[model samples]
Target: MTFPRVQPEPVYRNPEAVARAVGGKARGNRVTVHAPGHKKGSPEISILVDPSAPRGLLVNCFSGEDPVAMKDWVLAKCGEPEFTPGDRSERPEPRAHLKLVRRAEPPKPFNDQYLVARGYHRSATYDYTSTDGEVLFEVLRYEHPTDTKTFVQRQPDGHEGWLNGRGDAVPYRLHELAANTADPVFVVEGEKDADRLASLGYLATTVPNGSWPEDLSVLSGRTVYVLADNDATGDKKAVVAIDRLSGIATAYRIDLPGLPPKGDVSDWLDAGHSQDELEELCLSAVPIAANDNAPPGKPLSIFEWTVDRFVGEAPAVEYLVDGVIPLGIPGMVSAAGDTGKSFALLELHRRVAFGSGIYAPPIFGGRVVSEGVSVMITSEDDANEVHRRIAALDEKGDRFSSAGKRMIVVPLPSAGGARAFWKEDRRLGLIETDDFKRICDQLHSIEGLRLVTFDPLASFAHVALNEDPTAGQFVCSSLARLATETGATILTAHHMRKSKAPIETLADAREAIRGSTALVDGLRLAYAMWPADEARAKRTCKSLGIHYQPNRIVLGGVVKANGAARRIMSTYARNESGLLIDKTSGLGTSAPAQDDLRTALVIAIEAAANAGAPFTKTGASGLFEMRERLPEELRRIAKGRLDALAAEALERGEIVRSAAKGEKTAKWLDVPGGLFAIGLGNFTTGAPR
Candidate 1:
């Protein structure tokens, strides 16, 4: 039987040995080593040893060293040049390692004697358990012979004894925390502090090594208190915890009074602080409000400029739909009312959700590049309307079965009344709503999210988006942040300005989109759809041999691509099911193509009558004489086809012989409803003369 391939464990070197080889100093399991070829006073690079890391080491260069080079140098110093830099930014889901196979050998029974025999004394033990009370791992604290403190972890190997390496890291006493749903949870820095608080009959927990898990839904909708250490690192960790917990939980920062440098809750308790004092501090601490981050008191000084500051090759631009929609940025699609822009955006979202490989067929006539999960939030369409629209896209239900698995459709009216993501407050000016925060939290929790669409921008932006440029910019920037954080394309549908004239150019298309100029400027990509004007509609229908029905023919193109590619357009005819299908194929044909030839003859006959250069029916001065008057697209049609189409039009009464206005004897070949020739001399002779 075949089994899933397990990722091999990374080879790790002793932190002290690496520090010695690199002429650096070791602080616990981390080393601060200067960059190779470093000048005096240059900042040092930090190398951390982490067993759970894919590379077994994490490297950071605060000195602006190239990360790839710094990692290679550190690995070379540690005699493991094969190792590469690890991506430590992404925090995996908690308890993800539960499915992995355990070590073959069983863990030895752990006791104080085991450490005592090795000249070390056991100080404390913290059990990392699962929700079901299973002991996944244990973190053991030890006092070393060198008068220093250290911590090591061992995993339960299923049989009995512990394995050398640790299992999945989870919040301490997670089972207990999950059980007590009412009490406010105190989040401290270390396991010992959590234990201390737990001993006092209060619920508490801490994460392993200050690395916050990517998914923390258990603490969602609950009050959380972050008790940080009394040092710079602790302050940073507090900020991180607050940021990660944003939209997930209501968290507050607690700074204990009269604690020494680097001291923690354990030290505060050791100082004879009672539970009442901690509770008082917790109650008085202010909640971390949204957008509460304050700027630094002083501006940062200028740095030394260098020509070669950039270390690697420039990154290529990524796209969700090549040229039409860029990836990792916010963009917009807009059209007038009843123009089907929302339907177009929804269709795009569906196509992106079905996308999975390196390339896919262009769904909206643009290549699909990135594919994964897609989300669409509709403010105007409720559950039933959305269902009808989606159902119209596919009657067989085959595509929906596979695509629905990766697509999340939220109909706002049914879920709740539509809530604006950005709104103006009399006191606070412009601010993002709590709903926005919650939505962002949910988006972050979703793995493999590729696209997020907000149908009808005005629905989410409220009225301020139209009146205030600041609100427009703020809403767009906030959405951009969501896109960046989740690594997905954030697209929104907007309404175009109501106009009688058709949008004929890119500039016009830009102006046609409703809202302030800031809204258009803030987006990286913008596409627009519009109904064909009377003249263009008539032209298109005449060419394609179809009747012109208002709004049945639509034209759309990329109005703004932000330099990704040249502008492109596609002609679509709305089918009976209200779906837009590309009809550009009808325009492709030979020079003597029936559509072009007929259209040219009609145009030429009209132009001649208007210009007082009327053509006769059967002479050199006939319709072929007016070939140069045809539209540029049909000017290349062969002379013979032009004459044949003119003859056909005459025989079919598309064009008729009419008496000249001033000269009754002269006749001109004029379209049945076209403008008549004005003067006797401008008229054409009758029939086959």
Candidate 2:
């Protein structure tokens, strides 16, 4: 008969260690050896041993007068069983692992000591418990002949396994999931707080067992917020964390109202406080104000966020001209490159600044938008070109510097370096954002500022026109924001994208944007200029020539006129040496001489022959007769002696001769499709050609 090999007992080294670990020892009345055909032993279970027997399963002895053994002590009674060679092929000595269920007192302080003295079991690394006091779960580890201590046990399918080091042993996968960001970070003093906070909604973490780690390396590039507890220890630990988080993330602290003398975040959470209360506590906490926060006075309480509701300083009420324009908003003038938008803005700006008689209807209208709307222009256009245009307009060949208080042109710094390059490089237009922001700062420094003109956004920006949306988005957004911040109208100049929609609305301005769509949506006032004929495919708005009046503010003018709503107008005008002049096509400055009226009568008489009813001359007499028919309510003027004509019209230009000698003069006659600026699908007037 053969018996299974039994490994030596040191426990971890062999099956003998398991016996010792489970409080087992050799029997007192013991047989020297056993074979397959041994006597049926009088033990509860007999171990018929062979030379190939599994480690401690042997029916050798029956113990006498041993200590009232534990209900689940390691019993050495084993019965023999047939072992198939196939089953034992790989495993040199195969055996079944089993344990009996029985109640036992948990390990206590003196339990291990009493067990060692009895010699029933040997002592291991940790002392055993003699009496129980909770935490009574028992875990067992397996061992091998080579003294290798294993932390796993045999699987049911007869495979081996180990304790889950990845699960219970450590937490390596944190903040790796999308849900992590959705969870608010909780700060605790120790692991206990972490466990407690986990019970709540927060994903809390704690410092190491010892002192807090010098730097919370996890916060290096994360968007984590600190919520330190409200105690000296917690606060001290929080300070350490705060120092480590310098410039890493935004952080805050939690203050528990009437907190326990030694409570932590868990204590507060355990007290049944809602998350809202905790949020309130967090928000009320102030930032770590530096000791030297000697700000002059509280920031002038301006809640600029509510754009329309804002009412500026004492001079808030602005008076305007003719009630046609309530108060010009000192708006922005924009157009495609070389279309004359810049020259127009410069001309109107110059006129408004000096209060010249030739008002171009932009920043004019007599609204003192902060000291006659101070023109703070960051000369984004060519200074020499601007000078030439100004000279040509003035008839004096004078440049801007000579304009004095009327024109405040901020020249580009003459530094000869990359700075100079940026001044001219349209790709560097992002500098305009910085420029706008800096202007805000300057406004704060100099008491107040009015209208700011950031010309030709491309000169300072590097965004792809029309292709990228951020350029437009940024310009428009910043324009609104800067306007709100300084309470000054921001007129940023930008080029129109080549491809535009049917008709450009302020909203569609997002698409026509040169660089970023953000600029279009962000801007409240989007002034798009095209060839006038094709700003949009539909020619919906006015398509007058991209006009200019060089007598206005240098680069500080706007183009919107009176009675402006969200309306598109097709303006018709003549270019007077690059200055925009209203055109009265074939209109007379005043009532003509009787012979001149007679000439018109003769033309109307002759023209009536081909038409339905023209000899009456009502078309030519209409506007003139309406003046005579005005009642006191309808006529603003109280019927004083009228100078037959508005004098200025007669001075500069001559009127075209009509068909007859005594013909009455007619000004511009508004006709059909007048909403569009007199130019649409018909790009040209064939008669003129």
Candidate 3:
């Protein structure tokens, strides 16, 4: 029996084949094409297919069109069925990653008559040579009679003829650059600047138009100094050069001060700067290692685990401060402005460095698990401020008395400007500055390093931190890497978003953090502080029998932690020295102490009435509510206790609740005869019901 002829399935999964079928241009595994139904001139769709990628077929629409619909259109044009857009089996083999190689094309001989015909005079010619000194291309500078200058490039053809366009480009002095491996190389924007520096006996090279060369591996392990012109474009090109040379060499972008708006190194040299002065600037400039942001170019590998691998016990999570901030991880202490966050962080650093046993209470009631060396780099506080704060934190001068070298305070403002650890670029997002690398290197050199702190993250993390999650990730991940590599807990003090609402819950505390949510999510631990609301604050002060001060009381705790942890909020009072003292542990518990607190509350209410800012019976507005006047020590006391105290006072007539004149909704607390409630013989109350 003869079988019917079977038709083969159409293959629309190959990006190049589909692109060609749709009249699109394919370069390597990616292709650009216009949407199948739209006019063909404007290509807005990009399709990429590679078996090695996690997803073999990828499509993008540039004009804000639906990518799925665009992909379907492309597939339909390639003779694919409506239901076949999800198919991926026909993709090409995995593309191999290759290093860039220099490829030069033959050039035609120079045409001197060509420039003369255009009313141009040849001023200078710069030759771009190969590694062996063979001239590959010549860039000719031309000037018109009107003083207008322009440059044109031509390369030599095999027949000694010249071509108009530059052939495969190389560094201006390729042979010398490749041979002189010891001398530091300077890269400028144009050949003229390179030539100017070369005339001064310095090794210098440059690429055309301030662009990079085809290959730069020859400068591996060398020191490269990138010199920028005075223009904004020059600044951008210097950044590009630094980014490209990051892994291959130690690079520094040296700005020659006192140049004209569009002047260059040649102009700076002509201004009478000595070679020794230039060398001094280059030597003093910090070297930036660009490779810090480069990706690990390793191939993906999958590992198989067996049951036997689980036989051994896993390591326990270690902590720098037990049960609070974990060791070898990144954490943040965030608070609203003037909430004493800097003071709190500095105290924690001081306690950990000098051993907290000297202090009355530990940080967040969590004991320091590791006590070695702690380094604090502060951009917000200068040396004098930090010194005063250290003295206040250690009234006994313990910091100087014991383990003198345990703490290192680096106030960036005093040193110079507050050098940012990470700088945001319009194109590159966040890039690590040389200051960060230098600090890391110094930290690594210190023995027994346990902690490093960056005060007020906004000053150091120079980015649009609140709007960008990637910027948040870059900062946290960079700190995490440093922590993991150095076995130290990296802590950063950051400001929380300003909100009038009290942080009653841990979730609310997390929400109060200033930056992107990713900032908190990226941390292994996050502690937050916020002002206690009026009700909560008064209730606390009443129970503690302490005077209430709104700005002096704050509630804080570990809002986020990687593992199961005690997430309870703790109350702190700003002491005379601006240090936050944990007041929850100091609450009075005896019945006599409770009577004294209630009596103090009654007197406080009478004083408020006499002062004209009468205490309200309840509610947030009007004169401050009863709860708003509570002290920090009474924070842990139940709210019902205050309510019961108010009720008993009303019953005994020690304090009478009277509505203000012409206001029926609001009730004001007033003492009878305006006499002190405790001094009067009418006070009588039992334990709160």
Candidate 4:
């Protein structure tokens, strides 16, 4: 049978040919085509063709051709193709080959003239050399008359970058570091410092850039003194360096005083500091150790699962001011307006300063421990007011001889002066400010300081008392810490909330304290003071035979005593001289004595009325007869005292005087069915009109 003439498929020799055949751009350097008899797209029967044709034309070679003829053809046509032995098979395919060439790189740009135009003329160059003394990079410090100083670094490979970016950067003066490994090395922040230190005949080194180096292994086993710049960032970097070098080397951080912020060792030297002075400062630096970075040791386990562990191990409860004020415990004194809280605190301050018994019989029934120093930080009282109060306390004759020196009275400065206790800053909110630190330092310097009083807690606290509970707690906790650390009793005076209702009970009084409940919660002991009730004042007045002033009688009671059985109640009576007297003790004028005289006068008046010999005037025969008829209780009272009592009674209408004008003077008679008349035999049933 005669077959039609078969047409051969065109071969692709390059990307253009492949693009033409496939109608798409060639993607790669090689292409594959399948023969007609082979399964379409079968890799085994495919013709392997190179895009870079060696013969400069497409070759139509069959897969099963002679190997030597293919090689000779390739050699003759393409100058010689790289060949490798292939697997002998019934049907083999031509192998493909490829070669590659690299493109040239562009040159790096230099701007020496630009740097010069900017007034950057190199003043000094510091070589960052390797351990073998080969210069790996150079750090150039440029100076300008008008502009600030600038720095640039150049590498041996013509790579111009910042000093921090040098690829082969070692510590500046690495050779010197290697030679003086045993000597103390001064590690500064910059290359200039390192060079300046070296010029002073000292072994000095620094990192390539102003920043700390990542790999500090170069300083291993060496003694390094890192002189930190006087700024926050410098201090921070120095801390980091010290932390990194903790275990690897013996490192010390030297901080110089009187250096302005951002001032470095170079400035110190320029300020006329000598090498000897620098060495002395270095010697004062504290050494950095591995343990410095370690967290605090775990606290002792407080949870006791068994009684065996706690048997006989419980610590005794100590007191800072005995029973009333626990030692080293936080306490608060709160009072309503004009309640003599300040006078009470001043009295307490007096007792603490002189180590005398507080308020004679003791307000809270606690004895003073000793004559310890007392610190009174008052923000409400001015210097003159404080002085006046102190002078009044001195007049009481209860103050000790050493009270003047032992008592510290700090008056509240007007508006802008330093705060007595706590202060806040933008950087440090509340923990400790410069003023606070100064106060603390001053307090710590005092010997035997046992009592610390902050008058009006609100004035001393940086935070709003009622707005933030946490801040209140912080203030309380800080005071508590101070108390514990210094073994002092801390008492803070606070104000009570304004309310029309009276503080009847201890709980009511406690709730009346202004601000968050945290104030009471943080205290080991707390007391509240309020104006005495009208009935109480009346009773006191009647017994003491003194005119009653609501402000004169103040009642104080313990609101919280952490370990006490019940709240102790007490009274403070301010006399005409503005002296606060503890009424709990019979230290003031005897109320019982006055009560005896009132009773005597009542008996004499009732007896005279019953006998129809009522007193008719101030010095009448009836009044004289009544005095002679006085009872045994009234016998001891002086005639003048009895007359005064009778007059006072008549004025209050406890006794009535006859309005009849027949007598020369008004005749005084006892009120019928009155409190005093009821005790007498003449008891009238009707009320006196």
Number of the top-ranking candidate, with lDDT as the measure: 3
What is the Cα root-mean-square deviation between model 3 and the actual structure? 18.7
Measured by TM-score, how close is model 4 to the native structure? 0.49
What digit string (tens of lDDT, one per residue) describes model 1 on residues 1-689?
Answer: 44444454765768777778888856556778778778544347988777765457778898777787887787787776544334233223224445545475543444445456557787888898887888888888888878567566778767776666565567889899888888999888788889988998988988876767665766877889999899987887786787777777778889899989999999989999988998899897667656533222466555644647756644556878864577888888887778777777777776777653444334444677787899999989899998898788646574657666888889999997788887777665787775677688788878889999888788787647677888888988998889898999898898888877767755577788888888878887788888877777777777777877888778776676554332445577777777776675565542333543564465566656645666775567665554455555456656676667777877865567777655565457765644553232243455222
lDDT of 4 by residue, 133-232 (tens): 9778778777888876766666665454432235644678888888776779988888878889999888888776554566666788777898899987
What are the TM-scores, per candidate, against the unseen true structure? 0.46, 0.33, 0.57, 0.49
Residues 512-542, candidate 3: write the lDDT tens digits: 8888988889888899888778776777777
Alpha-carbon deviation at 209 in model 4, angstroms: 12
Off by over 4 Å in 1: 1-200, 203-307, 356-365, 396-403, 589-689
Clashing pairs in 1: 107-161, 107-162, 108-161, 108-162, 667-684
Better of 2 and 3 by TM-score: 3
Candidate-wise lDDT, in order: 0.72, 0.39, 0.73, 0.64
Best to worst by TM-score, what's the order? 3, 4, 1, 2
For residue 127, give model 4's deviation from the true position in Å: 9.2
Question: Where in model 3 is the C-alpha error above 4 Å?
Answer: 1-125, 139-168, 177-203, 217-238, 247-287, 292-314, 382-384, 397-406, 410-438, 462-471, 498-501, 542-545, 588-689
User: For residues 328-353, what per-residue lDDT tens digits would candidate 2 score against the true structure?
Assistant: 24334555555566665565455445
- Scored against the true structure, residue 677 in model 4 reaches a CA lDDT of 38
Which candidate gets the maximum TM-score versus the true structure?
Answer: 3
Model 4 alpha-carbon drift over 4 Å, by segment? 1-295, 302-306, 309-316, 337-343, 357-366, 378-406, 409-416, 419-447, 532-551, 575-579, 586-689
